[model samples]
Target: MTIEQMKRNARDKIINEIAFLAGGLTSACQVRAIICAYLYVDLVSDAEYREYCDLILQVENKRISQSDF
Candidate 1:
């Protein structure tokens, strides 16, 4: 599949996982957790896009790891 397709799939998976987790819990913590998961997915998508661009640049450069950045 294409990069864009992969990104969409990843996002859908993240949302499904978050929904499952949220379904098991109650109160404000659930909302917080869902928000965090959403943000995490967004970051993942952004990082993927950045890396794609970096590759297109065709220059040797170090990019921060997702866990570290």
Candidate 2:
């Protein structure tokens, strides 16, 4: 799959897992760590992986915000 596809798939997987695992109460650090575990340490470059994690973090944070209300 292309990078965009990978990113989308990763986002979906992470969000779903986080929602189910913690009922949308997970922290940013836990999200970041989960991203690292999913992205693969050696295959994906550090900078690119960080960018992907950042993107996912934004989405996850939005979920957290919505859940608060």
Candidate 3:
């Protein structure tokens, strides 16, 4: 699959795992384990992750500013 497709699939899997944790079918320890596994599979470096995080924060700030007006 393409990079975009892989990202989407990874995101979906993470969401599902979080939901399972929330539902108590999975323990907190299990959730942490899964998160570690996901992080390893993510492959993105710290710099790339930081850049994407900053972009998301910027978008969120802009949305909040617009809503306040």
The candidate scoring highest on TM-score is: 3
TM-scores for every predicted model: 0.38, 0.43, 0.51
Q: How do the residues 1-69 of candidate 2 rate in per-residue lDDT, one tens digit apiece?
A: 877677667777666755643455566667667677766734345775777566666667677688799
Evaluate all candidate structures by whole-model CA lDDT and list the values in order: 0.45, 0.66, 0.55
Model 2 has an lDDT value of 0.66
True lDDT of residue 39, candidate 1? 51
Segments of candidate 2 deviating more than 4 angstroms = 1-41
| Best of the two (1, 3) by lDDT | 3
lDDT of 3 at 3: 75
Q: Compared with the true structure, what per-residue lDDT tens digits does model 1 show for residues 1-69?
A: 876676677556545544443344333344335445545656355565444334323221222233246
lDDT of 1: 0.45
The candidate, 2 or 3, that scores higher on TM-score is 3
